[model samples]
Target: MQDITDVAKRLVQHNKGKITEVYFVACGGSLVDMYVSDYFIRSESTTITSGWYTANEFVHATPKRLGKNSVVIACSHGGNTPETVEAARIAKAAGAQTVGLTYNDKADLLAVSDYSFLYEWGDETRVHNNPMAIMLELTVGMVNELEGYDHYNTFMEGMKLIDTIVASAEKQVEPRAKAFADAYKDEEMFYVMASGASYGHAYGFSICSLMEMQWLDATAVHTGEFFHGPLEITDENTPFILAMGLGRTRELDERVLKFLKRYAKKIEVVDAKELGLDMIDDSVSEYFNPVLFYSVLSKYRYALSKVHNHDLDVRRYMGKVEY
Candidate 1:
C-alpha cells in the first residue's frame, strides 16, 4: 500500500498554490466514508472548499469548479463501482487531480485516478489502513503541507493509536451489541441518529447494515435536524440508535438523546466518550471517533445478523439482478 500522507504531500507539491477546492465522490457506504473526510476538510482547512457527492450525480452534474485547480478524491472499496470509476474519469477529464482509494490494486478506479492508495479492509490489526483513515490521512497531510495545520502532529500521534483504539472499542461494546441484537432482532424499522463526524456512522449503519444487509427498514436522522420533523416519529415503541461523539456537535446529539430518553423506549446510545476516544488528543479526537463508532457498530451489526439468521453478505436486489 502506498503511504497516503506521502501521496498527499506529493499532490500538494505538484499542485502548490493552485489547489482551492476538493470534492469527495462515492456511493453508499463509500460515500459515507467520504462524508467524514469532507467534514474534516471543511472543519480544518481555511483555504480549501470541500464538497461531497454521490458518484453518479457527480459524473452527470459535474461541478464547474472542478478543474485543474481542484482535487477529487473518489473511493470504491472493490475498485470496480461503475459510477465511482466514471466519476474519477470525469474528474480527470475536467483537469482535477484525482486520487482513488480502494482495497484492490487492480481496481478500475486506479486506472482513472492519478494517484491510487490501497486501503486495508477486514483486518483488525491494520485498522488504520481503512478507507476513512486513509482519507483522513490524505486530508490532514494535504492541509498540513498546503497551509500549516496547528494540530497536524497531534493528528499523526492519534493515528498511531487507531488500531488499539478500535480493538478496545470493539471489546467494550461487544456485550452491549449482543444485547441490542437480541432485543431488536424482530424489530422491523429503526432510526439511527448522530451529529458531526459520527453522522456518517449512523448513515452507514442504518442503510448498509440494517436496511440492505438485514432487510429491515432504517432511516438515518441527523441530531441537528431531529426537532424539525423527525422528532414527530418518536414514540414509546419506536426503536432508535443514537451515536454520541466527542465532537463539537455533541451537544446537538445530547439534546436529541434527552428527548429520546423521555419519549422513546427502545434506544441504544453508542457514546464514543466511553469507547476509548479519550485516548487520543482532544483536538483530533472528534475526527477519529467515527472509526471507534464504526467498530462498535460493526459488532452490533454482526450480532444482529446472527440473531436474525441473515448473513450480512446476502442481498436480495443488489448485485442479484441488473439495475
Candidate 2:
C-alpha cells in the first residue's frame, strides 16, 4: 500500500496542470468502492471533478473529458475483470494515465495500467480490512496532495487507531448482524435506504449483497427520493434497512426513520453514530463513516448467508460463462 501512495503522488504530480478531473471505472463491488472516493474528491476540491462508471458503460459511452489530461482509476478484486482490464487499455490509448487497484499483482488489469497497487494478504486479511479502505486511502491521499490538505498526513498517523476501530466495530456489530440475518433470512424482499455520506453503503449492500449475493429482492433508495415514489410501497409489514450516516444528512435519514417507525414493523437502522467508532476523531468521522458503514453492515451479510446456509461465494452465472 505504501507503493500505492507513491503511485498516487506521482500520478498527481505528473498530470498536475494537464488533468482537470479523474474518472474511476469498474463494475459491481469495485464501482461501489469508488463512490466514497468520488464523493471525497468532489467535496474536497474545486479544481477537479470526479466521475465514476461501470467499465462496460465507460467503454461504450467514452467520456469526452477522458483524454490525455485525465486520470483513469480502475479497480477489481482479482484484477482480471475483462471489462475493467479493457477499460484500462482504452484509457491508456487515450493518453490518460491509468492506475489499477487490485488484490492480485499479476492481474491483467495491471498489465494495461501505468501504475498498479496490490494488497497481498492471507485469507484473514480479506475479512479484517476490505479493499475499500485501500481505495479510500489512495483517493484521499491523492486529493489531499492536489488540494494541499494535510489530512493525508493525519490519516497516515492514525492507521493504528483505524485498525483498532475496525476491530471494535466488528465486535460491536456481530451480534446485531446475526440477529438481523436470523430474523430476515427467509424474507423475500427488503427496502434499504440512506442519504448523504452513507448512501453508497445502502446502495451497494442492496445490490451487491442482497440482490447479487443472496439472490433476494431488495430496493435501495436515497432517503431524499423516498417520498418521491418509494414511500407508496411501504406498509405495516414492510422491512427496511436504513443506513444512517453521522453527517449533515442525518436529518434526511431521521425524517425517513420517523416515517418508517410509524408505518413499518421491521425497520433496522444502522446508525454510524451509534456504532463503536468513537476512537476515530470527530474531525474525520464524518468523512470516514462510509467505509465504516461497510465494515458494520458487512457483518450482517455474513450472518445473513449463514442463517440461510448459503455460501456467499455461490454464483450461478457470474463466473460460470460469458455475459
Candidate 3:
C-alpha cells in the first residue's frame, strides 16, 4: 500500500514538466482507471481522460491515439490477455511511452510495455483484481507530475486500519460472509451500493467476487443515483452489500446504512472503525482508500475463494472472454 502511494506521488513529481495530461485505458475492469482520473483532476492542472472498450474495440478503434508525449498505463491482471498486450504494442508502435499494471512480472501486460509494476500481492482469491485496481489508483498520483504531497506514511497508516479490520474480521465476518454467501450463494443476482471511497470497494467487490465468483450481476452504484431512481430495484429478496465509508462524507455513511437496513436483502456494513482494522483516521485523503481497503478488506475475497474451492488466481483458468 505504501509502495504504491509513493509511486503515485513520484509519478506526479517526475512528470511535472513534459506533459499536461494523463489517460487511463482499460477494457472491462476500468473502475480503477476512473478513480485515478478523479485524483488527477483534483490534485493537478492536467486533463484526465478515461476510456474503456473490449480489447478489440480498443485495438481497432482507439489504439492509434498514443504518441511520445503520452504516458499510457494499461492494465490486466493476468498480463497474458491478447487484447491488453495488443493494445500496449499498438501504443508502443504509435510512439507512446507505456507502463503496464499487473500482478505477475512475466504477464503480457508487463511484457509488451516499457516498464511494469507488479502489485505486491500473491493471491488470486475471490477478487484477483483488487491489487491491480488499488495499485493503479495509488500510482496515478505519481503519474500526474504533481508535487508537494507526502503520501507514503499517510497511505500506509490508512492501510494499517484495513489490516486491523481484516484480522478481526477473519473471525467476525466469516459467519456473516458464509451466511450471506450461502443464502445468496446459489442465487442468480444481487446488488452492491458504493458511495465515495467505497465506490472503488464496491466496484472491485461486485466485479471480482459477487459477479465473477458467483456468476451474478452484482452492481456498483452511487448513492445519489440510487435515490434518483434505481432505488426501485431494491427489494427484500435482493442481497446487497453497502460499502459504507468514513471518508469526507459522513452524511453518505448515515444515508447508506439507513437505506440498506430498510431495503437491502442482507445488509453488510464495512464500518471502517468497528472492524478493528488498523486505520489512520487523520492522515488519509479519501480518494486513496481503495489502496487501503483492498490491502485489508480484500482478505474477504481470498476467504470466499477458499470457500468456493477456486484457484488462488481467477484468471489462470478464467480467460478474459470468449471468442
Stretch of 10 with least lDDT, candidate 3: 120-129
lDDT of 2 by residue, 1-323 (tens): 54657876887888654567889899988888788778878777777788889999999999988888888999998999989999999999999999888888678998888887776444246422456667777777777777766566665654446666666777888999998888887799989998866777788999999888899998789999998999998897788999887766788899999999988889998887777555566555656677677777878888999998888899889889977
* CA lDDT of every candidate: 0.89, 0.80, 0.57
User: Model 3: what TM-score?
Assistant: 0.74
Instruction: List, residue by residue over 96-178, the lDDT tens digit for candidate 3.
Output: 66767776677867767765666544533322235544544454445333433455456545544454444555567657666
Q: How many steric clashes between backbone atoms does each model show?
A: 0, 0, 17
Better model by TM-score, 1 or 2?
A: 1
How do the residues 1-323 of candidate 1 rate in per-residue lDDT, one tens digit apiece?
78777888888887666689999999999988877788988998889999999999998898889899889999998999999999999999988999999888789999998898888777444878888888988888888889999998899999999888888788888898999999988899999999999888889998898888899999999999999999999899899998899969999999999998888899999988888788898898999878887778889999999999889999888988999
In terms of lDDT, the poorest run of 10 residues in model 1 is: 119-128
TM-scores for every predicted model = 0.98, 0.93, 0.74
Instruction: Sort every candidate by TM-score, greatest first.
Output: 1, 2, 3
Where does candidate 1 clash, by residue pair? Answer: none
Q: Report the number of backbone clashes for model 1.
A: 0
* Model 2 whole-model lDDT (C-alpha atoms): 0.80
